[model samples]
Target: MTLNRPDVFGSISLMFWSIVIVVCIKYLGFITRADNDGEGGILALAHLTRSSLREGSRRYALVMILGVIGASLFYGDSLLTPSISVLSAVEGIEVAIPSLSHVVLELGVLIIVGLFVVQRHGTEKVGKSFGPIMIVWFVTLAAMGLTHIAEDPSILAALSPHYGMLFIAEHPFIAFVASGAIVLVITGTEALYADMGHLGRPAIATAWFGLVFPALTLNYLGQGAMILNHPETVSNPFFKMAPDWGQIPLVLLSTMATVIASQAVISGVYSVSRQAERLGYLPRLTVRQTSAHTGGQIYVPAVNWLVFAGVLALMLTFGESSRLATAYGVAVTATFILTTVLFCVYASSALGWKPWQVLLAGGLFGVIELAFFAANVTKVFHGGWLPILVALLLSTVMLTWQRGVVLVTARRTKLEGPLTEYLSSDAVVNVKRIPGSAVFLHPSKQTVPLALRENVHFNQVLHNNVVIVTTRSLNVPHVDDSERVTIDHLASEYDRITHVQLDYGFSDHQDVPAGLKVAAERHGVELDIENATYFISRITLRISDRPGMARWRKGIVRGLAQNAARPSDYFHLPIDRTVLMGAEVNF
Candidate 1:
């Protein structure tokens, strides 16, 4: 009876079309073209868009804000994806053994905790098998789907455009409402786009269209066939398609696939966090490179534990996969909308697209994304509030931190720039020029290091030759070694004072000593890595009572600063030799 209704058909139509509209067109067709030198994410997109405009322009600032919000919201979704994906599969146990349904949540939490615990060790070893494992999972899914499709081969008609069009035309209001539920199929589409940088566009596109898309098509159509044959199975047609004896193995296989998917999502969280750090949206964390051969593979312990805590809370609070699903589409929909907006800007500016071209692509995708976004908004009170709340909170922190950094830089900018006089013999007069080189890690090359100024003001001692170094994260993912370090002068590099600017890709690690050593070797500058004294500044944040963010957020900025990884640790400066000069900053 339900299958005869246009509304039922419309829902399926909307679901299938969304995958084509959002995932296939918006991501694969357009957004993937916006990758920044093999690095992909909201931040990369923002930086790429920023590169097309004049530095310090308002439009640049606007794009940066969108990226920050998207990245923050992504943080919220990353936790949910793993929890929901794993829990939903584990829940298949209920279909296998209805009596064991009670243990699903407990087992899901246990698996999630285990996943988080092993994050510290890095996935370089286990990661190699991911592609093969996923291939097997997908093949298994296709085979299972094939078993049921034979029962009602006519169900394949759902893939035809005429059915979708007729259903939407016959049931307009129901089609509109069904858009929300239908969007669930395309939830991870943005993540696929985000990871395309490392994996490359061709590989990602191949995987999506080649194996994944076909497998998904077969599985959904097969489920549709099963539901049509036995309408009672509509409640859980996915598991219902499998016979009683095969249900247990299906559950086992589903759990394995979900766990693998969840692990990849967790790795994405860490990867995005590092990108945020390099792009200056967040404070630095302790970054550990997992593999010696690959510089990109990294682990952040804090992020791992925080994500674990969030997943744990969601597990206890929602307690059901269905409830978690209610919260899923909101963050993802918002991100898609932002990605489309940003891609429009990038296409118009850098991709050399005409206004009409931008409008055509953006308008089409924007309407679909906005419709889904609005539909998801209706679910806010019903578990959808969690991610929205997390996004707002995280965005506030990012914006506040950025604002605080701005105020600090503004204050220092007026007073500090390259002190040619400080580098001169006159300023160095009576200053005890100590032995060995002193590397001053500064935020800006133009700004005189407060540590350099303070070292002279207090002890009145400076290293024989001073190196004022500032590291810049480029829009791209990897900066070539040839162009990695840029020095101020020519040969011997001004024996008394030299300004060094090191360029790194967002995915590159921040290693002050390594960058310095490489620069020294290339330039023939004298340097002893062991004895070099690294100078860094520690800011004491003070609320200005100034017209800025709310008082609560200023406090959060302070907390972030307090909890941020120490400069010595983050920059890999030798602990015993690193000198921290404390400075007070007001925001």
Candidate 2:
């Protein structure tokens, strides 16, 4: 930013106003109110809005696309944030010990690597210390900034709307450019909403207003005051604010805080990926529950490694935090803009807001976010293109996986026909019955299980008791254990066939065997837990080079299906008792 030599007053004004408008108002005021059950985030909000709309409607598809795009943008932010935050903090070594500056990049990369490696073990152990560390960190920031504020008391005047308006009015172009950097102050504001399910709105609000908001304000103000006294220090005012002795400790503290900060986003990436799989926008990956007591405590090795690789590439290519800064605001602002648009959809579809009311709220928020987005647009040519490219690639992958599921499901349904029609057919009634129970996992109870049909087609012997289990993920956060799972006695014919439908919210943990046990107990079915063989149809997708998608897309979609984790592991089934039936599908 010093390269541009923009006015300090304009930059400072824009910075404070951004925190107030974007963080304090736009998110807290409107966005967080539209959570899906107790969960809140762009993906959760997308599910909430879609839940209100009729299935197969245009609005539902539109909301799903926007949700997927918002999630992809989050992936971009997750990659860029850790690199920039850690690098920026490590650069403070130059302030504490000028001679040690040469090792800053190496140290930054090392710290980031350590951060990623510990991710698989999960945050359960160190997470207890995070609260205390951040509390001390924020208090230190406030104390540091409060002492410096006495140096130039006038810096407080930037808080007024007048200064912000005047700065924008007098220097429109510079204020526009300043907004791109000012956005750095509010980078993690979305976390407030994303984590609402974990902490709840009341706790998040209490922490934000009672501690975070004040601490951040004081620290940024102190930096402004220090820069006011010595304008030459504008290059890195944050580190320059501390005295010689305090600089080293501050640098160490900053590094720790940045690591903690990066951990939050990495955890967010894991959560969004889980939701994507649950909603069928992605293939089921290996989800290891890091905490046995906490259902949401999950870690994905694939997502972790991919994110680390992306972060490393970003650090190496950008070389400095300043260059990476140009890439930051684009993804954050784009996500914010989309969230605002999605909220408007929710306000109308769910809340039944009038047109004027929606316009007054959403239009105001949209125009502000659009301005921030436009300011960020000026940076695309200046190394800001990375996140955009990342987002595009992710969006393509998500769309491909989603489209592939539809095609595969359609093909299967057409081949097997409905469950009712098939069960009532002459062949099922007279087929030779074998011993032991066979449980088949299917997507829908109304559709015939491909594994069952194929099993009977080849072997020509049906199990004496064949149980078809269809698991569904709903749009809310959790499902009560008692309401949904049931064994369809009437649907069962020849006293050997039964249908079990298990329903869960997207955020719920799914255990097929456990659910079946409950269903079996309630229905008075004599079930042997270990003796039952769980069957799953393993699909090998081929490139049909269909009309809807290009040949390359078809190949990519096929690769995703072929590489996905096996259904047994994904669903937490007993490995020894599971049987997978393979089939080829060219679509």
Candidate 3:
């Protein structure tokens, strides 16, 4: 009798079509094409769309804000994913032993803690088994679904689009509420897009259409069929699908599947955080390369522990997978809406699509995503407010960081002066010529490094081989080795002063020592990179009554900078060979 409710069929229809149209067609088919030089993510997509536009234009700024919002919401979703996925899987134990339900939260918390603890060590070994485990899980899902469908062949009627349409027409309010729950079906779709760089579009598309889609559809339909036959199992239809003896094994397998999925999401968060840092949205974080061969395998301790803490808070507060599910869709659906918006912008600007074509596709996807977003908004008081709150907080921090950096750069530029002028000035030309090379890391080649300036003023000496290394993050994902470094002997007036500009993409690892080594090998730049003295400006900020950012926001920026990873650690520079020149920046 419970299965007779319109919401049951309505939710199933919404979910099925969502996967078909939203995930399969919209994201996989169209949005994946908007990847930034084979990289796909909100930030990368935003960069691609706004690449042709002038950097300081209003449109560029607007698109970047959308990327920041989408990225922030993604971070929110990342926080909740581990808690919900693990809790939902572990909660399956309650079907076999209802009394054990009381320990679900505790067990889930312990499992999540273990997951974060293991992040310090790389996932290379654990990653090898992920494919096989996922294969087994999907095969199990398909097998279970096929068995149930055979028992109730009539449940297949729900596949007809009219069942969903009729249900929505008959019970509009129920369909609206159900839409929020329906969205849980496509939870990992964004992460799939985010990881497109690593797996590539072809591989992801093959796996999704070939294996994942069919299995998920069968599982959902089978769950609906089971609910129809045994109405009392509505409380936990998925776990209830298994027979008494199979429940424990199913629970164990489901837990492993969820853990693997959560691991993917955790890795995506680290990638996003790294990209954010490189793009100047966040401060430099400590990034460790887990695998020497694979540059993409990295671990961020700050993100790992922070997300773990958030997951624990959510689990302790919600105490049930159902409640956590209510909070989940808000961030994810909002991100979907933002992604759709970015795609439309990309289609119009970069692809040179006709106005009508862009509008037609954008309008169709916009309606679907907006409906889901609105539906999820109703659950704000229920539990959805958590992610919204998190997104807002993170967005504020990101925007503030960007703004503060701009203000500080403007001030610091005046102090350091032009690099060309500084190099040719009497202060540098008359200095004592040191024996070895001194590599100074600066953000721009046009500006002098504060460290170099201070060293010249205090020590009154310049290295015979002065390499001004400036690392710039390009809009693309990976810069080619040939185009990676440019060696410029400034104005030919100073042969000893060489300006080396290093270009990197968002996904590329920033290793100053390695980049310099490549410069020596590839560009034939004469230098002792191994024993080079690296000079980094360690700026201690002091707040002033400046015309730039608000004092409070400036303070926030200062705090973030203070806690950021040291330059030596971030650039993988040799610590013993690096010297920190302290400079005071007032803004």
Winning candidate number (lDDT): 3
Q: What TM value does model 1 have?
A: 0.90
Model 2 spans with C-alpha error above 4 angstroms: 1-10, 53-58, 123-126, 290-297, 472-485, 490-493, 502-509, 514-522
Give the alpha carbon lDDT tens digit for every residue of 271-325 in model 1.
6787787777788888776755444456789998999999999988889989898
TM-scores for the candidates: 0.90, 0.92, 0.92
* Ten-residue stretch with the least lDDT total in model 3: 1-10
The true-versus-predicted C-alpha distance at residue 487 of model 1, in Å, is 4.2
What's the lDDT for residue 585 in model 3?
A: 93
Native-to-model Cα distance after best TM-score fit, residue 547 in candidate 2, in Å: 3.8
lDDT string for model 3 (1-587, tens) is: 23574556666777788888889899898988777656677888887877956779888889989998999999999988998999999998788788998888888988898888888886565577678998899989988888888988776777777878898888788788778877888878888887665557897899888888999888888888887777888888888888889999999999999998998788778777876886789998888767544444578899888998888888898889887877778999999989988888788777888999988988888898888899999889978998889999999999999999998988998998988877878887778998999999998788889999999999988888888898886756578888899988884634678888888865577888888888999988878987899999999999999887889999999999999988787687988999999999999
Alpha-carbon lDDT of model 2: 0.81
lDDT (C-alpha, whole model) for all candidates: 0.79, 0.81, 0.84
lDDT of 2 by residue, 1-587 (tens): 35221245556667777788788888887787877656667888899999999999999999989999998988999999899999999999988898998898899999999999988786565567677888888999998889888887877876766777787887788777777777788888776677665456777678888998899889888887777778788788888787888999999999999998898788778777877887788887887766544445568899999999999998988888988887788988999988988988998989999999999888777787888889899889987788888989999999888987888777767776788778777778778988788898987778787788888889888888788888886655567778658667535544667878888765566888888787777765555666999999877676775567777877878888777887887677999899888777767
Error of 3 at 120 (Å): 3.8
C-alpha-based local distance difference test score of model 1: 0.79
